[model samples]
Target: QRGECCSIDHSAKLAIPIMVAKSDGAINQLCQPGKKRRRAITRGQDEESQKASSSRRVTHSSVRSDGGEESFKWILSKRQFTDDATKQVIDGRHCIWSRRRQRIGEFDEFWTKSGKSWEDLTTVKDPETVISNFIAQQISVHATNANSNACRTAVGMLFRIQGFHEERINGFALKQIMKKTSCNYKEEEKGRTNLQVRNPSEAHTGKS
Candidate 1:
């Protein structure tokens, strides 16, 4: 009877006799008058319920998402440092930040010794502070050397890189840098005009 039931596809509807015959063992055991059969049925139901509950708990607690769970497990397994090592790294000052400062200082000292055009150290004494100020100065100098309009454009680019998409540098600050750099606005304008005049015919042809 069990073999016949196993052979039949579940999708195909079977007659009552066939269903009864297939499940005869389970039905007889369950319906027997003795308390043993009753106990067996109850135990089977309890076991099934426990299995379902266990599965639910596991699924609920486990990290889900196709590749995410596997990736997380991989990362966790690859970590070499124990809890103590992690605590030491976190609590100690001899880490990445200190190493970065040392590297920057070495570079700055080398440039100073070589008499190369380095950032002014008189204004910013701290290594970290000097790093930021130096970058700002370099950018300002580049902007000034490029052209009169370059300063404003450079400031816009700086703001975008710093994650401020909408903010712009004030006109006064830009004017101050331009003045300090001694970039001659009038000379640049005159040069542009001279170039335009020299190639007026070529410019007109290209435009058309």
Candidate 2:
């Protein structure tokens, strides 16, 4: 037990609190809304109207400085929704999209809310490509220097949490490819770091 004693390291435990893990968009990252976006809790508002709406979702609107401006900026549902009114269907005892995200088949659609309009992420035939491209673009500017694998996995998890899954969106394929990419990139970065440490003179001259 050299330099080791039972001090009850909480990190070593199998389970950790959501806040402790800083998962699902961190504790406060989601608080900041985009210029035209507002995060409103679905209370008091026509929460019942959602069930009757063809969209089958709550809408968040944009506001102006001088007055109140409204537009369907985003779908504020605990579940996922598509522009396709047909997507709003009841599956057995639950909304097709609920606590469990399901497969929307090969032609699933994801409506990404940007500023004024919704970006249909599923315009392409393949959802996996869309997921990979989006993650690749995001990791380059992420707060943490995340690799594609982590970024892709995080986005995929978010979609799943939003009641979307399988071919309905990117599935295991993107994760597997990015996982291998992350491993290879980590190995390369480690080799470069070790080379610099082993030969400081070579580090400056760009020689290994």
On a 0 to 1 TM-score scale, where does candidate 2 land against the true structure?
Answer: 0.34
Residues 16-111 of candidate 2 have per-residue lDDT tens digits of 664566765663566555422532444424565655573432221111100110011122132244534323332332431322232211112222
Instruction: Give the range where candidate 1 is weakest over 10 consecutive residues by summed lDDT.
Output: 63-72
Q: TM-score for all predictions?
A: 0.19, 0.34
The local distance difference test score of each candidate is 0.45, 0.43
In candidate 1, stretches whose alpha carbon ends up further than 4 angstroms from where it belongs are 1-152, 161-168, 179-183, 188-208
Clashes of each: 0, 1
Deviation (Å) of 131 in candidate 2: 0.7
Residue pairs in clash, model 1:
none
